[model samples]
Target: MDAAAEPVRRSPPWRDLLAPGLATLVCLAILLALGTWQLQRKAWKEGVIRQVVERSRIDPPLAPPAAGTWDPAADEFKRVRITGRLLNDRETLVHGLAPGEAPGRALQGYYVLTPLVREDGPPILINRGFVPTELRNPRDRAAGEVAGPVTVTGILRASEERGLFVPAPDPQRGEWFNRDIPGIAAARGLTEVAPYLIEADATPNPGGWPRGGQLRVDLPNNHLQYAFTWYGIALCLVGVFSAYAWKRLREVA
Candidate 1:
């Protein structure tokens, strides 16, 4: 007798795939949304970089905006010129890391923030620059602290926000992690201080101890790569579902 004819196989009904199909659609939508959001972020970051370059590289620094008139958003990164006398007595040193000549290397140090006493307005914080651990004391670099009036030209910057892991500042010990402007001002008994600080350019100080010109604008931008990654994952999911459905339909009875 001839072998019994094998039963023919057929695709499952649409109703059988409804639940899985819906789930796949939802996942794809989520992934696509993430990819789109990253693209938008990429555009915003580009605009920020352009603005920084334009505002920071202007020739012949612009006048420092009048106190109470300066807005952080509009004036940050602007190259400004200010005439003031350095109040070397009340300087604050905020901990930081300066970029080293070798790639991926950083020199751990402190930023010298001296209050500039301006005749026209309130005291403004001036970030003279990074000084190594050895020169954290004023006596080590005493000559750099000029006694007479001086002209400072540098980029304006907003006060830094402390991170979750940053250490709390100790005024008594003179230990600081982030540049907390209000906190620093209050600690030093300064009132009506400028909301923003100035990062001085590479002008040579008398002793060249607190090296200036440490304004670094290095915003990370990997949105394009992230977008591609999300889209690729979604594509793979589609391929996997297609293969699974094909195998199920071709099963022999």
Candidate 2:
């Protein structure tokens, strides 16, 4: 064949990449948006941690909120003092894990939640503390069942939201998974019950079977790591797309 008569070989049409290019652009936008959202979450989480730290630093326990004045958002984590007698007969045990004697170990237990009947006000629930599985029965820890007028100092907490996978509480069987305040009050036939609960301090109990002061304030802050992951993916996508486009253009040139 004569050189001048040879047919020209053209590259694939640019329109062939229209679908992939649009897809890449959409994915990049989504990844970038996700990264930005995570950064906003990081800032929000930092603010929450700061608020908790400040609240923890406040010395001298504040008085418990009165009925009709209770605000979970405002009072959560606030240390408060209450003078009342514990109604141990109506105590509830919620499944939990507490720090064990050995380092880095956790003890499977139940949080002993008892209602405290105030002399002049409605009764309030108190998380007396964690009791090991073996000491779940009140009879096992008889000495800790304090009677008469007594004072309790602890941090106030709001009712917990049920998880999707959590089983419904069996009040009849005395089995509880989450802290459902209203449900517990109803089960115990308690009237004029406070809306919040208290996590007791490390004060010594008679037998010390139910260990107090297990309330943890540490919240995981991993938004920064997630943000970085999303941002990194976006960068990689851009680099890969750019390289592909460059190679395609060279082929066409």
Candidate 3:
């Protein structure tokens, strides 16, 4: 009998191999787990988006939340109405942009933040929107005006939690810095104010000097996109592992 024909004893793969294949499998499992986690996150974000849409469609702004009812955490992005007078002389022009004005282009301009003292409610800051670069000057800021009791309807916006890369206004150095609501309020001596600001809706302001009604309610929901990316990576990794195992088996054979 040929020596090859006789049952040539061969060591079993398990007995001969010193493989850490378990670690590779563990890594693949972890990636799959992460992919699943992202999918869950996507679901959570989608639900929030739907809730926001529903709340936004609410007609006629409801009466301002009662006193001691202003919860910063809860009140964020709440649709609300303010029936108050605009204290004209007390407007602050922070950095912003308005193209259809004196500044001419995308140059820095004023964001007219005027206090709307509600007749029987808390004062909510109204961000009327951008003016022009010419209006950014302190004197220009002083000269510009919004006047009298105006029924402004808007969505309550959270304070800007980010800063412009350009230098902040050095108030001590007598410079107009960034558009921080709290800082602006303190400088202007506003009282009994809500921590949120109002961006006016599309209600046309007749006799408009500083136009009232440009609230941007656009929100970007990219959790779904992110979830898809992670899932795709997991699938690709699975293909890689399968290919690797096939090659390894062939080599052993």
Worst ten in a row by lDDT for model 3: 137-146
Q: Residue 104's C-alpha lDDT in candidate 2?
A: 100
Model 2: per-residue Cα lDDT at residue 39:
98
**lDDT, each prediction:** 0.90, 0.89, 0.65
lDDT of 1 by residue, 1-253 (tens): 9999999775556655678889999999999999999999999999998898899998889988887788988899999999989999999999999988899999989999999998888899999999988898999999998889999999999889999999888989989999899999999999999999999999999899799998886578899999999999999989988886666656632
Q: lDDT tens digits, residues 68-132, model 3?
A: 77665566566777777887667776656545545555545666677878657667778866666
What ordering of candidates by lDDT runs from best to worst?
A: 1, 2, 3
TM-score of each candidate?
A: 0.91, 0.91, 0.74
Please list the residue runs of candidate 1 whose C-alpha ends up more than 4 Å from where it truly belongs after superposition.
1-13
- Which residue pairs of candidate 2 clash? none
Candidate 3 wrong stretches, greater than 4 Å: 1-20, 96-110, 132-144, 163-169, 172-179, 205-213
How high a TM-score does candidate 3 get?
Answer: 0.74
